[model samples]
Target chain A: MSADLQLGASFRDPSGFVFRKNGVLLRQVNRPYLESLKRLTDSGLYGELTEAGLLIPHTEVGIENAFSDEAVAVLKPERISTISYPYEWCFSQLKDAALTTLRIQSIAMKHGMSLKDASAYNIQFHHGGPVFIDTLSFEPYDESSPWKPYRQFCQHFLAPLVLMSFVDIRLSRLAASYIDGIPLDLASSLSSSHTRFKPGIGMHLHLHARMQAKNADAGTKKETRGGFGKNALLGLIDSLQSTIEGLKWKPEGTEWADYYSDTNYSDAAMIAKHKLVAEYLGAVSPAPNIVWDLGANNGEFSAVSTSMGFQTVAWDIDPAAVEKNYLQRRADKLMLPLVQDLTNPSPSIGWALRERDSLIERGPANAMLVLALIHHLAIGNNVPLLEIASFLARAGEWLVIEFVPKDDSQVQRLLASREDVFPDYTQEQFEASFQGRFTVIKKDSVPGTVRTLYLMKRRAS
Target chain B: MKKLNRALNIALACGCLLTICQSANAYIDAGSGSYLLQILFAGLLGGLYFAKTAFGNLKAAVVRRASMHKSDDSASHVR
Candidate 1:
């Protein structure tokens, strides 16, 4: 197999590494981990977790599929359609992922196995809920040892959740900066004084940070104390679980969270817009397998694409809106709701800047829905219409976009706050700008509103 | 319940005393503090967990008994 086929993110784990062979993703289990892998299976942890949809199921492939001579076994795991990062998840999504990790840890202990790492990246939003994807994370449980992943779990999941809940929801973006996880020290420093009083936060964040600082210089002296018994470890997991479950962020106060109810669209116009979107989506030749609903407030329109059996991802900048959308579509296997700031989308980072893929690297989706979002980018953020058009062209092949005219109430509301510096922000100029990159396929005006919707295909180079 | 609480209090006190030693070790380099924290709180945490499990069992038993009593009443009415 070509060395270039190896995934950048899969190199951190020594037990196994995932690579692509003949375009099929395969994981090569190294010799050192063969015994642990056996224990994982023989202990029945793998079967139980996968059966409950808590773990990604994998099949052992032929040894000939190994990526290197160090390989002892090869396996092919289920592919997650879109790999999202912890930074891109909403408050509830991160909370759920944290709870899922703790749940998996507790279950693993029951079967004489434990997770060696608790990186949030190991969990993915698959089949409408979070599922642990790393099959090689399990190792033989050591009853006398404290949970090896205790610190990692706190950094990757607990710290971020606490910061988001008590401080500011926008602090979750810290995950993008600290890929290993937001440092406990940083989280502790940023936390409110009230958090210091909370038992879980006090112990896990504040006290944990202090301990790390106090022992920062201590050399590797052997732990000269009693063993951390099995009951103690279980208690640790239970405490983490209760702490996470107790933390909650109500999805309100954000401007866009109530966009649907606060919008100027009449009942007839809303229905017409939804109908037009479904019709335009259906008109795409050969049909799109994946659809991205950008600026998808509460995923009101994303449901149209999902209803048509296409895998749909609803991305909104506001955490409140995304949280609402996620809760509404939690059971819909075809729909995924995530938080994203399109202006500053997720960037490629980590070793050699290739470990985690940037937002654009994962896309050029089959189709993109840009409904009622142009004004926000053009007038609200001062991004030129041409630039917005070009960015969208690079993001997807087909575009179903709405052009809100200057007279539209939403555009007027946006213009209310700032100077109307956009003389070029007219409907004709919008069409002219987008037509350069996308050929206009069809256009229709909503019956009760002056806003126009267009079905456009990316122009051939 | 009182016995469980007493045991937990004793564990917490012991954990507080152990913190004075301040020396510990672990394989993972990033969180030496984490290892110490776990050692210090393990007893209290374990005692609390035991209490929680005991209370849960008590609640489950009460619910089961209530359901059985309701079933007996329904059976008498049916006869």
Candidate 2:
């Protein structure tokens, strides 16, 4: 019990390992990596990256609780509210991460250091865009050394982006199944013939896969290996930069991408709903720190929560809608948009089912925002009111939900296509089902509509 | 026995040429080879681009000088 619980995913790196103690996360730097660590900091690479907000800043802490004999230094990095994987990211998010990694590698090369690894998992969406989180990934650059992370970068960023853009956007989620990254051969195979004509795709993916296959089959090691000059390394980085920059994914219209434009709610009703939600948010004591906006289509309500200075996670099932939401999140904002269907969220994946967490593992946020979302979960999805209540109760300390009556055009539209089997889908049933788990403190019927917003606090045990 | 002796001699020569005949003491794989190939390609492509730019600049300079010489002759003749 005294041993610090080391993070499972961080064990791959021998230079340093992250551990948790007394609810605080700390990284223990090993003795063998001290020289490279010094080079990274002393060469001013650390300061430049941190100043530009491209790298996570850390403070060296006293090694009072050095977990192991190899611990040379302990660092406390800025805590990210939520750790989201690359698979959860949209096309642009993944693209930005790839470009950021390339930029880091270029800069590191200039400072006589290079990234030893280029896993997309090393990048995290912080403050609005991707930032490098792995401090131990850098090593002293050798002029003659080939970039060890080259193949990894291609698989992690280049292949996935190419597949997502040229083949299918949903193919980006393949990052979840292939943690190392989508294989190059698979990416090339999945892409269309047209993609082969694109310069970037042809060289980095198609030709790269062929080279990999050839190398694997030959099983030959060259006695006279070629050396890479600094210029050549920089040229490689530049090629990757242009290739990533040239790639683009236009947001295609989906079922919910333009939902707001065709909504039944009048302008006045929408305004009233926003106002009531704001008021309820103000009524909560001590002010909620984090809020999860479930089914936040294009993040209109999530924007409100963010404006109030709450770190908000905007979740939606529609890929296009989530993509649009992420595109609009400002660099200084507190919103993370993700594509997630509530019925089937991201499951525990990777080795031992602990490397990546399930959706519920990272949560129990300070508050939940369920505006215009309950109807879809209930009447549309056939989920019982009690089950929904129980799930919501486990998800947050406070719940702000909106009740859409069956007579409403939105609900009628949902029922229009399917059987109207949800007999207990009413306000009375909702309140009754939630009463055991939450205390309803405030309720208001939105003006100009039958929809009602309720502010409930999870009942104290 | 003669073939074996010849093979040993070749091995010794190769070892002598490659001085420091020990294991690499590092990790290098097919991916490393692929990366080296990329660097080679990038270097070639980049060098070609720089060469083209230099050639274009040289052509521009030569053309400008020729035009200047023609102007000078015309101006002198008019004087």
- Every model's Cα RMSD, please? 3.2, 9.9
Which 10 residues in a row give candidate 2 chain A its minimum summed lDDT? A216-225
lDDT of 2 by residue, A164-216 (tens): 78877888778888988887778878989777655556666777676666555
lDDT of 1 by residue, A262-321 (tens): 999999999999999999999987799889999998999999999999889999999999
Instruction: State each model's CA lDDT, in order.
Output: 0.87, 0.81
Model 2, residue pairs in steric clash: none
Error of 2 at A448 (Å): 1.0
Q: How close is candidate 2 to the true structure, as a TM-score?
A: 0.87
Residue range with the least summed lDDT across 10 consecutive positions in model 1 chain A: A218-227
Worst 10 residues of 1 chain B by lDDT: B20-29
DockQ of each: 0.33, 0.08
- Candidate 1 per-residue lDDT, tens place, B1-79, comes to 5465445545544454445333234333575778878877887788788787888799789999999999999999999
